[model samples]
Target: MKLTRIAQLGAVAAVAALTLTACAANEGGSTAPTSSESQAAALSGNLVGQGASSQQVAIQAWTAAFNQTNPDAVVEYDPAGSGTGRESFLAGAVNFAGSDRAFKVDEIAKGGFGACAADSGIVEIPAYVSPIAIIFNVPGVKSLNLDAATVSGIFAGTITKWNDPAIAADNKDATLPDLAINPVHRSDKSGTTANFTDYLSANAKDVWTWGSVEEWPAGVVGEAAEKTSGVVEAVKAGEGSIGYADSSQAAGIASVKVKVGSEFVEHSPEGAAIALDASKIEDGRTDGDLAFAIDRTTTASGAYPVFLVSYLIGCEQYKDENVAALTKAFFQTAVSEEGQSSAAKNAGSAPISDDLRTQSLAAIDLIK
Candidate 1:
């Protein structure tokens, strides 16, 4: 996905003139409310956000819908990786940040947000939920069954060939290729990498020694690519190559069915929701911070454990009231039912449940 920048900071007369008519009134007559009294009062301003290439498609959808209501709101976002987004947000280079993972408890404790007033808290809302696909490219082989250990061994560079006994054992029906197995990984620091590594570290700790990390471990060897698209391209170009990425971008690539208890499960919006329902919010977070601790080791039926919960990170209090209003309004739009449906249609992401949406909106309301 390319950088998404939508600048619609000009007023529409029809939207600005919108007013609410009072229905419950005396026999005198119904009266139209003033612009200030109308609940649909339009907002106008520019908002800049950076981070999480995984959210590029969803952001595009969101900005488009946000403009329908707030036509004068300028929304610009750069799909720079997640790490850069967090750093930029902390530095006050952008109004908000999008990250696959929320800031750690220690990082929040430090509390020096440049965009916020002194001693203000931060708000992190899980607005996007998606499954990470294990995509592969092997000639004459479009599908294969992969378990945690076999996947860990392949990515860890322990299993070099496609016809290895471990791989062959799970895929007895498919023809095992004798070609070399090439694994591709993200070169940059990424939340997707964090989620992928978390799953491996939890289920395949014996083979994958490294714990959950945003950066690829130095000792682990593989073909390195810059972002999600780069990894997809690398796997597409290389024969017998495999990589993990957001399911939306893994459309053309052959995906693996990961083992979940007694059955092999494929990645989908429903499957991702199942995995998300099994997760819990992290402890030690403020009411405005809805950071999730995903249950990556889940074996529940129809659950796709390798999923990511992308967050929209912002300050609970901004230095400027206009900036605060714009940020809060945009976040409200993002977590709204309409916004979630738009994302589901455009990005193939699972819509957050009604309960989660209500919680997210309440958190966004805390912004000032």
Candidate 2:
């Protein structure tokens, strides 16, 4: 799969940065070794990773933390969309990828991932979990709870005004405007779209006919932005606009509280953790391939239904021993409690549960 020009530039810059850092380290005569160089030495080479713009904030934090501990190791991840990340991983353009979705059954059957041992299967571990916030820019509406149908109607274009009865029912006390509603969506092929669509499909199947897919379905219409930041910006700029984005990216915007079972639940780190706890790994797959089958339709109280678990997709074995070691080391840190804590500080994402952590660590040990 071909990468967007922006992603290609990012990959080039990452490699160049590593090259310059190595040259500087050699000139300094400091055998103590810088973190980037040490990682490079450990991985025996430079590492390139790309995919999942939804995890951009968390990835940046993880990269910074990993660099501090392994100075010589140079690792770069570009926040391309999940479709691009998966394509890059399958094409052998990256050492690993960060994605919101696992590889499809067909892709696995075709032997798309070269990183796994023959029949060893691929690893798709959910390292980051967060709520998909329904952010809006209505001037006075700060808090709102939307049931499944109302949300489906707004995005489906059937409900065009903020003062529509469906919305008014959810916020009976608030003064909603009669202005036209603008619904913003991601223009790119995104895992955010998949998660959002999955929620809609599961909860309001009659209103939303689209099945869960990375690319938005045809005939389903809305204003489209290229990334989570773009969608957030669009909503912020347009009055009466609503958009779906990773909760961490919904800065300065009003987010909607979704109705869960019997309560109107606001999205929080705790709520997301509850959702993860309610999920289980898919039954099939080898021990090394840590793919999970989350129950998105779960009605577990206190759990936000819009929760998304982002995965760090990587090969079980790498041709370069150093890359393999670096991948394993960085991932080990990521799955650890310390790494999860660091991510929460930097990105406001939900940490993996202790149970999931144990499973992930055991799976990472099989990476060799």
Candidate 3:
């Protein structure tokens, strides 16, 4: 469950500069440490997490806020790909892991999360939810609207030219030059790729032949890059290039407004949040675990289907007591209203709903 609410900046690209709330002292002048101080005092030593480069901006905000309250708590999170993060967590290299996709049933059954106690159930909590913008660098095309079928064709390598009628039909007013279209993709194992492909497969199954996968499939033609940043950079360097990335990183590029049913919708924090609200948890995932099954066939007029629901995964019971305690505290601050606000300010992400907050807090309580 995610309690965090992601909000607006500009075109969902200008992350509104976050203003810090002043911490006023208590009126009683009690020497007793206030709640914030006590939380800080309660936490000491380092906590580490690794995964999902898309969550880097949010992690920075969450960690900074955590450190202010608990100066002694040194939390370090490495923005490695989701595959690396999951590998590290299962190998006991990190106390917690952040991933765009939740653990599969087979993975949960394997029982190799080295940090967990012998019989501890995995706690998969949905923390960050945001839109993955379809960013492009096409000359004279400030805004191009493409429907799912056309998008699938371009990414699938069937639509090679920018001025192709299939694309031109979508953006009739935009002067799409007769240039070769280069589709940049993530070469590395990435959750972003998984979600992006999932959207394609769901909305345009006939055109997007390659099904949803973390790694790009065989015979799929595209300029492959290492990670989210690499994909963006690759697209930026090439003329008439297009790539998909988290909306936060798409500041300089022209993001496409995707056609969802009758209307083309721009990516916004509220737009993304509405999609999540309409989604449901996956089947067989009960108790404290949360793995969202986003319906990519969403007809929610303004909601964006290319959204990522990032998860912060940990063990219900840890082998090291301190790891469990520290992990719990870090996440507690992560989903709090202040923590959610920090994410919005830094990443332009939508905040999680209130019911999700309650379920997430309940899940956190299980981290014994």
- Per-residue lDDT for 1-368 in model 3, tens only? 11112211121221222222423223435454322345634677778788898888887777766666666677777778887888888988888888999998777887878868888888988889989999888888888899998899999999999999998887878888999999999888899999999999999999997888998997888888887899889888988899999887887688888888799988888888888878999888858788899988888878888899999999999988888888888787678766777788778888888899778888988998
State residue 74's C-alpha deviation in candidate 1, in Å. 1.0
Query: Model 2, which residues run further than 4 Å from truth?
Result: 1-44, 114-120
Greater lDDT among 1 and 2 belongs to 1
Put down candidate 2 lDDT per residue, 39-150, tens digits, no spaces: 4333334567888887776765556556545555666777878888888888778878888887766677688575554554567778988888999989789878899889
Per-model TM-score versus the true fold: 0.91, 0.87, 0.91
Candidate 3 accuracy as TM-score: 0.91
- Winning model by lDDT: 1
| Reference-based lDDT, each prediction | 0.86, 0.76, 0.81
Ranking by lDDT: 1, 3, 2
Backbone clashes in candidate 2 total 17
The alpha-carbon lDDT assigned to residue 175 of candidate 3 equals: 89
Would you give me the overall lDDT of model 1? 0.86
